[model samples]
Target: MNFSFLSPVANAVLSHNELLSMQALGRKLRIHSVEEGIPDLTGVSVALIGVLENRNSVDYIGEEYDLNEVRKAFYALYPGSWNVTIADLGDIEKGESVEDTYFALKTTVSILIEKKIIPIIIGGSQDLTYPIYRAYDNVMPMVNIVNVDAKFDLGDSAKPIKNNSFIGKIILDEPYNLFNYAAIGYQTYFNSQEEIDLMERLYFEAYRLGEVSNDITIVEPVMRDANIVSVDLGVLKASEVSLKQRLSPNGLDGKEICAVSRYAGISNKVSAFGIFDYKPSYDDEMTEMLLAQMIWYFIEGFNYRVKDDDFVTGNNHQKYITLAESHELVFYKSIKTGRWWIEIPFLANVNNKLKKHTLLPCTHKDYLDACNNQIPDRWYKAFQKNSVY
Candidate 1:
């Protein structure tokens, strides 16, 4: 609980919060302030932490940024009927060295995870995800990350890590804790053919921007199995964001991005969530309001989470067996939620990441595909990865 690296929320935001209605989210938060120091985290289910480190951004020009506007927009909103307690632990100022900032973030996130509290990180650059990933080293034997971005971000591992390529470092670095990585809303033109091939060869998942926009529900099962979820603001289309924050002309709109965030929050297995690569503008109310609503939807989704993964009791789920070619696919449907899961058979002899039979989240469509002798792409890739591991 050594959060000495964190600075208090800006006084300007506090002044703004004081004038808001009593039902505003700012009024309900356990805020860390100069007067009160860090808030007591007791009964806190979610902690908000902001990072001011953007040196690793590919377009870095020594510019500084703050989340004060985003906080103001967030605080002015009314909270849902959420039962979860939220705390704003404030921002981590840019350290003398980028590594110093990374160390502070890794330590803070690790401490929060140990207490079973989810951290909703707002960061200056997406590369900060590297430290968040590292924070999971001792907490879990294996980790699955879902990155909602327009690029693969598998930059050259041989070079210094940048926001666009930190995934390369994550894949090549030590501990080898990453079990699965999925990219949602990735644009083909933004990535090289080699990166695309690498994703397929490694059995990693990638969904095209058009594909996700066409059907947002496809993200649910992927998010359902993820341990950490990271979103890059660059995924928003040019028209949806401010001039400074725009990255692509073709990207997710406001409604789609919020849906994605809600999916991340609803995932029972997701422990850490972050939205990165924010650039503040003079009149950035549109982007700030959108980001605030995204956070709101995420919190709203978290409040409705139900544990449907427990298959110990046969009465809770209905089991179905289907044959696809020579493969026998076992499916489970939660009686309570109607959600589907496919079983990945255990191979006792292989030295694999999964030591026991595991359930992979799937859709009702995947079940129908199995009945039609068509194997789901998700099941095939997961099975392939498991076999190779």
Candidate 2:
């Protein structure tokens, strides 16, 4: 209830009451206004926060941006059959400096996480993800990040932070809370050969845009293991969005993007979700509606969340073991949902930060591959990362 760092939404954005006649989501939203102060979040499940700081956006340069239009679009949507409480805490106006804004975000999000509320962020630039990640410092020691974007955004950390290069800062900064970073739908051309090599050398995961476009479901396992998911609007094909600055000719379509959002919501481990790099459009209904639907699907998925992280009881899951050449691979499948996970053995005498969780979410194909005497790349990479701890 003490959201001291936030500013309430402007009355103009909620002035339109036409949505009331249609049973839309606008009616159900506990919107922050000048009269009511902050919404009581006692039992709120999801809280929406808008970051109006774009000074770090590498593409926006010196221009100013706003999320009022996107807010209007999102608030006009119809809520599906869901029981989860949602509130819009309004925008975080740009601070005197970019770092000032980061501090505000870090404090606000950290408090919400302590209250067990998932924060969905709409941002001025993708760089806001850094603060969102930082907010988890006191909540959890280490976390896995899944980015749905076209570029690696690993710009040189030696220089000041920009939206495109903030990841470099995250990976090298102190406290080193990042356990794993995964990039989904990265365009090879956008990333240099050296960056690709760096991904391999660091044991991080990156799936090319083509791979996921062909089979969108491949993203399920990756998202399932993530604690934070950051999405850049620039990853959408130019046809789907109206960003004049960066016109990506090819990327994930609206449907694929929504499915990705749903997968992030379905993951029990995912605590924070953000959509960034939104270019202020004049009157683009397509882009607005698409973003609204994405939010809708995420909430729908959250409403259907199941308790499946427990693997010791052996009551709701079936376990399978396979020998690839030298090491033994163990897999678990949920009897209720048919979802799969593979176990990565912990190193002896090593204290890992991954407390009480060693089973990595995987696919049925990984089990089939193990049965054929092949080592699943996911298991191998995870094992290698864990060994370093």
Candidate 3:
């Protein structure tokens, strides 16, 4: 478990931690400090790493920043009744080249996932997600990403990867591990019509900002089915964040964004989680506090996770079959957690990507829609993608 790429947490934050209450989160964390180096990770469930590379941002102007404010705000909070152990693994300093930074991030995230430790990344730009996604190349057969963002970020893959266009690289790059990508809280106005049509043509999922803000629970099933969850702070409404960090006036509020993070945390399949595009400011207290709370909710949800995916037990779930149009919709409801999943039948031929029958997480509304002879959009897209791949 060599973490040579990591730089220790600043001494100032460590000094500040000593003045806090003994019950504060700062006292509870296994921190990487200048004196002790990286902390022992034994029995640690979650590791936090900050990336200080923003050179790839489309609007880069050679600015430098740090995550100390976020750390200080997070550390001062009191932890909930949680049994999970967390370690702050410090930050990955900007490398000589953006590619070098990406390599560092990819290696770090890969190592964390190999040890079954979820890495909660706080980054300068969302493009860091590309390296994180690449980290899963040999770890999983297929990957699903859920981005809590305002834009589709499907920039031209033919061009150099930037924060706004990294997804294009993910889709066109080697190994081709990306199975499904979903954008939650996307504002149509922020994305071009071509990008919206591209999302449809590729069978990827995109939920509008208004739709998600009206009902945040709609994101649970999407998050449940995801392997990587990347969040853009720009998804927050302008009033909810600092002036420098604000992007849109009509975006997710603090409560809604925090709820989304919790949903991502509660997902059994989600292994990597990241929050990106944080812009430091003189009056960043509000943004820092909100970011801290968002991380707290994620940990809180992680603590409450339940393993209810085993449908073979038969006794733990109830199966229902309904005929909608020409499709036979199979639904499974977990008795333990009351969660629902819709089965995606495996296509007989044509090089199936899933290789076997798979279950797609769905909401109760999907089941009711099937009963009324309507196909769930999620099921339809998944079925179409599975058939094609």
TM-score of each: 0.99, 0.97, 0.99
Candidate 1: stretches off by over 4 Å: none
- lDDT of each residue in 174-281, candidate 3, tens digit only: 999999999999999999999999999999999999899788899999999999999999899999988898788899999999899999999998999999999877
lDDT for residue 268 in candidate 1, whole number 0-100: 93
Task: Give the per-residue lDDT of model 1 (tens digit) for 157-275.
Answer: 89999999999999999989888999999999999999999999999999999999999999999999998999999999999989988888999999999999999889999999999
lDDT of 2 by residue, 65-155 (tens): 6777777787777777888999999989899999999999999999888988999998889999999999998888888999999999888
As for lDDT, the candidate ahead, 1 or 2, is: 1
- The model with the greater lDDT, 2 or 3, is 3
Selected candidate, larger TM-score, 2 vs 3: 3
**For model 2, what is the C-alpha lDDT against the true structure?**
0.86
